[model samples]
Target chain A: MTKPLSPGATIGILGGGQLGRMLSVAASRLGLHVHIYEPAANPPASETADRITTAPYEDHDALTAFAKDCDVITYEFENIPTEALDLLEQHRPIRPCREALRISQDRLTEKGWLADLGLQVAPFADIKDAASLDTALERIGAPAILKTRRFGYDGKGQARINAPEDAADALASLNGAPAILEGFVSFTREISVIAARGLDGRVACFDPGENVHREGILRTTTVPATIPHSLATDAVLMASRILTALDYVGVMGVELFVTDTGLVVNEIAPRVHNSGHWTQNGCQIDQFEQHIRAVAGWPLGDGKRHSDVEMENLIGEDMDRLAQIAAEPGAALHLYGKAETRPGRKMGHVNRLR
Target chain B: MTKPLSPGATIGILGGGQLGRMLSVAASRLGLHVHIYEPAANPPASETADRITTAPYEDHDALTAFAKDCDVITYEFENIPTEALDLLEQHRPIRPCREALRISQDRLTEKGWLADLGLQVAPFADIKDAASLDTALERIGAPAILKTRRFGYDGKGQARINAPEDAADALASLNGAPAILEGFVSFTREISVIAARGLDGRVACFDPGENVHREGILRTTTVPATIPHSLATDAVLMASRILTALDYVGVMGVELFVTDTGLVVNEIAPRVHNSGHWTQNGCQIDQFEQHIRAVAGWPLGDGKRHSDVEMENLIGEDMDRLAQIAAEPGAALHLYGKAETRPGRKMGHVNRLR
Candidate 1:
């Protein structure tokens, strides 16, 4: 087996958002330096990172230098530029692999990939043009989501097809970008599996957590999701299967819809997911550290939950209640050092132990 | 009461060792910035700190600039130059107070202060010259330790007088430094309480941890010390008395000797201590964060222990078994990104939950 990264080695992280910020902290705990590569001048992750390359992804010189300095490379976001990643690939290996990123970058590709792997995915149809949209609408019907194949996140880049009459308007909203129509599924709750795979190919999954969304943003994730024991096992097995199939070497957040029949795959994040933030307070090894371990070629840690936690995101005005939130007895607050608190902006999160 | 420091305000930390490194990280988690003012270039704390001022404490310009930039100032170590502290104090307030620093900086001073509080302390006598050493030795007797009054740590600046014959040699070992003769206590065990005092004068103490020392260096600190519940309460009460007497703002590590009679205060650290490192994995709010909260004028967080933990320091050669330690189940490893490993140099620590 390849040797795990020695202490003092650098881990290059693409994208310097909250995920990268948390990942940098985890890497610091493991004696690893993080070089955050982000276009923004002073992104949230830059504060704690050893150094930050405030250059655009298209900058070949910056990408090459960052990769050369790092022993291993990992991205906090899946939407990193292909050219930058290709240049970095020449210097250091990227964890979660380019294949995982490529598949997850496109909604159509991800849905098809999951279906091909014999997984129960949401009913999705690719809409290449008006004719394709019409044909898909005929097959899938209305009350679907018209999401852009690329660059969709936090309920952005998506349009709701509430009725067949709204199809034209929904398509128009995407500005003619390549899209996919996902037929709605009646599910009792949404749960997510934060799974990790070490370089040695051992897949481990944290217990699934039920999620709540407000205004298209994740509000809270409660661990010990009130699902049947068998469904939790199925969710973990499904996540494990996907990770193994992708040959994933880092943490992936698999979102699932708990229907009457079984768990249906909703989406997967090829990096530490927001839903898994509860693990920071609930488990010995949080998702950030788990991702860092996998990418560093270290043995995966036992992520057994020691506490039941409900993680609530502090979006925008939610931070106004900071004093009261700070006084909450069992709350573990993690604030991203963001300069501004714009509406819907994620300022921080508090994991309240239940 | 003064208003609490805002989330984005900077907290200047003096001395960039592991404690500063951890405190910097905790500050980041609270959305606060840390400017680590350390003389050592590329110190472990600098990696995680937002910025580092690598100038000697004697540099007035550097110290002044650091203080001007930070809303509040704190330190990871005692014994900072008085001139530097005076300059910083002109611009910003130093938490835990200079009084606490002064008392803890000198072994003799600390012992006297503890005794003045009506807390049980080991017999200690100030030794200025040869005559004082002889007179103190006559009272405290043989088998005592000759410790430097100031600037000693990890067995440094201290020599043991095991017998009457060794007394001369031990005194000579100190090289004319102001010393203290501490009579050895026949204690069954040593335990430490990590205590905090907020700006609001609220006090909270973590469960006392039984400490084991090897070569005068802390080896392990296990929570739930093998002491009666009564002694634990007494230990907390004693620590509370010390904090209250000092009007201390921030966390302090109070080492105690658990004898047959009761708990005796061995010493106190003005900042977070190695014996309390297990709180990182065991408690809702660790000593570092607790210290930050106190100094920042925020309400003290709940210091309740959620898990039983044993923290072992990885000193020098102890790092050789890193692979084994990393593989151990329920182990949470925290490595200080120090480049070289020398004898007795603290490289990292591991917290293993039982």
Candidate 2:
């Protein structure tokens, strides 16, 4: 991994969702071919990837073949099976490293790790059972969120507590799995910074994008966020600290809560995040390409924004407006090739250049 | 052909070169898939295309199968064999139509067609043999270029006649094939306009880019060409006239010679051209996407340039500068995945934003 990958090298991607789809396109742009490993047939990324292995993550044969063909391995989602990653890493280097994944995959570990860096995160308590849930609720406060320590995203495996009376029901819903109760932070808005740390340890960060979520799903991300310039600089510094701490290589998405006092990190994704999609239209090099460059051990591109952009997610039925969106001037539509339109599914997104 | 192609429809691209590779990427961005038909195995576009048919154009069965899978067919190059196109059009529609290909494939027909339209083309004569070559040299005079009537590109299949004595050698260099002799125009600069005409006959043109050539191969394309505003307007109008006359349905590149009196029509490419590569970084919707939209019957995306950009081609050993170029701020690199590099071969290109 000391030398940059030559053009025509194969990059192995563990997931074949839209992020992987975009990643494949970016890899192709750099003359790097991608081999996608996903269980579903004709996954979104299969359309652009050079090769695809349709097998479950637990299948050792498929994993071995995929690893054997790749110059380097990366994953689109952080929730990849630990056993699968351990196997892949034995054959080829897994970028952003296994340490980043281990921390970001579990809520308790992620929160504790961030807090250890003297960073401001919401106050939280770990709960393993009903008795612990009551104690944690008492310590964290009544208005809190109880989330499973692992495999929780988009409001799944999460329940809100209005008071102590809800603790029993929340613990029962978790079925005694390890969880964390986080007291809600009073914040003005939510924003995310997408930064890439190259193999050379140099970090480049795009302008933080202000985010709006509807029903716990990201709705829109607007650049030139309402945050003051000073606050924006602080956000970038905090993100750099996280990247440095992880000894990270490749793009990482850091979500922050803008409060009256300062910015508080909510969470961090070890791969490309939805909020950074605006960069595809707003910058010379996009987040996907930034991630690819970092993973390929190439120099990180300049992550400077060149124009104002607003990105709106076309979730599920929202894709029905495809024609209308296409007809809109300056709107760049990116639709994932998913056949079914299940509610809340991120079918695609559109970046409108202003 | 009347209705706009629905998202997820497959676009059949005729060639598997860099243009087709980029066209596949653009088609994927719009939720459409691309099936590339290429005679060579592991062609550049094969990395990103959803499907690829690897067989010579003479294989009628392969062409039929490719057309059957695609909703609409478009080509990356103009010289696709007529027999293959004839078979493809039977199963699917070929956009930019057969007329554009028929006229553009032959230098004699293309020049005749342009001159008949009351356009300003260079003084020219058709040379069918050595006798015709001598007669054409006498009429067009020395200081002319003798080019094969078909399949000449990147300065190949061409010879220059400096004086009357050089006419025989120039015609001999063409191997007695049908040729054309054209007197060189005294122009200040070479510029190209990339335009698209939709199914409904609506046309959108990008600002012209000034071109610089090295050994007759394009080296760089700089947007905001050093031309008067009125002349730029005329360039767009001239491009529109060509598209209208052809009843074209796809992107076309119209190369022009900016002279003291007016612009002269140099040539026309019925697909995405090298000079338009700058739009990839300078505009929200690029020439590749515009071509896909025109063929898919979707409304064209905005073609207006938002940033000043200089696009330089990475030909042959120019790829040795990948590290240095990738490190440059605001430079976006695009590499064609060709395993071997040869002099005059287009390996990739870089678009630097100013």
Interface RMSD of each: 0.9, 0.9
Please state the error at residue A337 of candidate 1 in Å.
Answer: 0.5
Residues A1-354 of candidate 2 have per-residue lDDT tens digits of 679999989999999999999999899888898999999898899998989999999999999999999999999999999899889989999998999999999999999999999999999988878788788777778899999999988878998999999888887888777899999999999999999999999999999999999988999999989989999999999999999998999999999999988999999999999999999999999999999999999999879999999999999889888889999978988989888889999999999976
Ten-residue segment with the worst summed lDDT in candidate 1 chain A? A323-332
Interface RMSD of 2: 0.9
Candidate 2, B74-95: lDDT as tens digits: 9999989999998988899999
What is the two-chain DockQ of model 2?
A: 0.82
Docking class of 2: high
- What is the number of backbone collisions in each predicted candidate, taken in the order shown? 0, 0
Q: DockQ of each model against the real complex? A: 0.83, 0.82
